[model samples]
Every structure is written in structure tokens, then in C-alpha cells.
Target: MSGYLTTHILDTARGLPAEGINIALFKIENGERQKIAETVTNSDGRTNAPILPAEAFEVGQYELVFFCGEYLENHGLTGGNLKFLDDIPIRFGMDDPAAHYHVPLLLSPYGYSTYRGS
Candidate 1:
């Protein structure tokens, strides 16, 4: 099997990649979140290593929590008390064990979106 996982973040509002951002991956079971992986983004808005290695990859539900508040602030964005978004949680499920999973987040201070990539 060659299953694995990867992710990246882009700051749409600033037209730059989101670096220095922290992301945590959690496995969900019975409505509970158990931390599985955590890392900070590199200069390219992606971790240097795979989020989930093939040896540990499995079919299950997972949640990715992205800390975007500090990132926005670092990029000179300030919303004081009216920020529309901060910590963003994206939930997804995996059922295939032999495929590659790339989840990329396109973001701004107020909103974000994601899609599966090759």
C-alpha cells in the first residue's frame, strides 16, 4: 500500500504562502478527538515531512485544526474584536488505503476552503 497524507496553506488575502502556522491532526472516534500529528508550516506553507506516513495511514475520520490568527497578524492583518475566523477545523474521512491524499487550504482572515489534490 502507498497511502499517505499531505497539506498546504495559502493566504489569499496577502497573496503569499502561509508560513509559521501550526496545524494539528486528530483522529475522531465516537465524537472524540484524539491528537495524532502536529507540526508547523515551513516557508512554503507545508510541512517538510508527510503528515501521515504510509506505514501509519489507515481508513478513518480525521480533523485538521489550523491556527490562522497569528498567521494573519504576522501578515499585517488586524481585525481587533471583529475577526470572522481564527482557528479553523476541517473534518474529513478516508476510505481508500492505497491512494495519496492531499488537502490544501485556501485561506484568508475571514474564510477558507479546501479540496483534494493530486
Candidate 2:
């Protein structure tokens, strides 16, 4: 079995899936960021497909940039010019090539949390 990367966002404040949020996946190499994939969250707060599919998966450092600011603004949760939680970047490493990588974000207007999920 080959590993792939998947993610989702839950609005902690509203207790619902965050929809229409933009997410960008980047593979980091030698301190440089290379964008690999980009997608928007559906009604279920998940992408239709894995951001990093098995065939393209590799063991390395990666980052997921979640455009939380735009989502918050759309939902009327913005804080004027500077929002506390804007673009949330979760940087992690995938060490196993045959394991599923499920990174889920629990998000609120002022805070967020994430973990390796099943």
C-alpha cells in the first residue's frame, strides 16, 4: 500500500464543516517551498480527491496553507484589518511511504488545532 495525504477543516466555533476554504499543498525542499496542489473544501470540508495522491506521495517535509482569513471574512467573522487567525500553515513531515496521512484542522475565529487523524 502506498501513502497519500488528506485533510479537512471543522469550524470549532460553529460546530460544522468549513466549506469553500482554499487550501494549498507545498513540498519543502532545502528551505524552498514548491507548490504541489491546490483545492477548495466542499460542504463536507474535504477535497474531492487527496491533495497528495499515492502515486505522487513521498517522504519529506510538506506544508498545508489554509486560507482561513477569506473563509472567516465570508462568514462575517473577520476582525477588520488584521485577523488573529489568517492563513494557517501546518508544516509536517511524512516519514512512512506506506501510511495514510490524515491531517485535520479544528478551526475557530481566534484559534485552531490539528493532528494526525485516522
Candidate 3:
């Protein structure tokens, strides 16, 4: 099977799937970010399917914006005070678009971490 772009979110603070989190995928064009797709994490903390299908993969700079603050607030993981993170954006390039780009985010109310995955 061919590879594609995908992502998953893990709420480290809550120790569960970060369900219903909004995610947007974009590609940089002419020094500006252009929207490609937007999706919300399912109950399993993953998009319904890959963000970019194998056939649609192309070499370019891409970005993934994860709306963590709202997810945390709606899930009761945050208090009434203003949340620390609003929207977290991960920017990267598809050096080899043919290869799978698995970007996974491990998130908390105050911080988050992400890296290229297999």
C-alpha cells in the first residue's frame, strides 16, 4: 500500500484521546499559507482517514494546526482562566512526499510535543 499524511493527538494531561479537536492542514504557497483540508479528530483521536491520500502527496512545506485549548476547555481539562495554548501549529516539509508523514502530537494544557512518526 502507498503511504500518505496522517496525524494523531494524545492528551497527556487527560490521559485519553483528544477527541473533537479541530485540525487544519495547509501548504505554503508564495510565502502564504493556503488551506488544504480541515478535520476534527474522531473518538479515537485520529482523523476519519489520512489527511492526504497517497495519490495526492506532493513535495512541499505543510502545516498542521491543532486546536488544543478549546478541546481542553470543552472537556473540562481547563479552568475558567484563559487557557495557555490557543492553537498549536506544526510546520514541516514533505522531503519525500511518497513516504508516509505521520505527525503525532502529545499535548497538555500548558504545553505539547510533536515529532515525525512512522
Best by lDDT: 2
Task: Score every model by TM-score.
Answer: 0.94, 0.96, 0.92
Question: Which candidate do you rate higher for TM-score, 2 or 3?
Answer: 2
Taking the tens digit of each residue's C-alpha lDDT, what string does model 2 give over 9-60?
Answer: 9998888999999999999999999999999999999999999999999999
Candidate 2 matches the true fold with a TM-score of: 0.96
Model 3's lDDT to the true fold? 0.88
Assess candidate 3 and give its TM-score to the true structure: 0.92
Please, what are the lDDT tens digits per residue for candidate 1 over residues 75-99? 6674775556778999999889998
TM-score of candidate 1 relative to the true fold: 0.94
lDDT of 3 by residue, 1-118 (tens): 5658999999999899889999999998778999988999999999999988887778888899998888888877676688878799999988774589899999988789999999
lDDT of 1 at 42: 94
lDDT of each: 0.88, 0.94, 0.88
Model 1, residue 71: distance off in Å is 0.9
Which consecutive 10 residues in model 2 have the weakest lDDT in total? 73-82
Better by TM-score, candidate 2 or 1? 2
Pick the winner on lDDT between candidates 1 and 2: 2
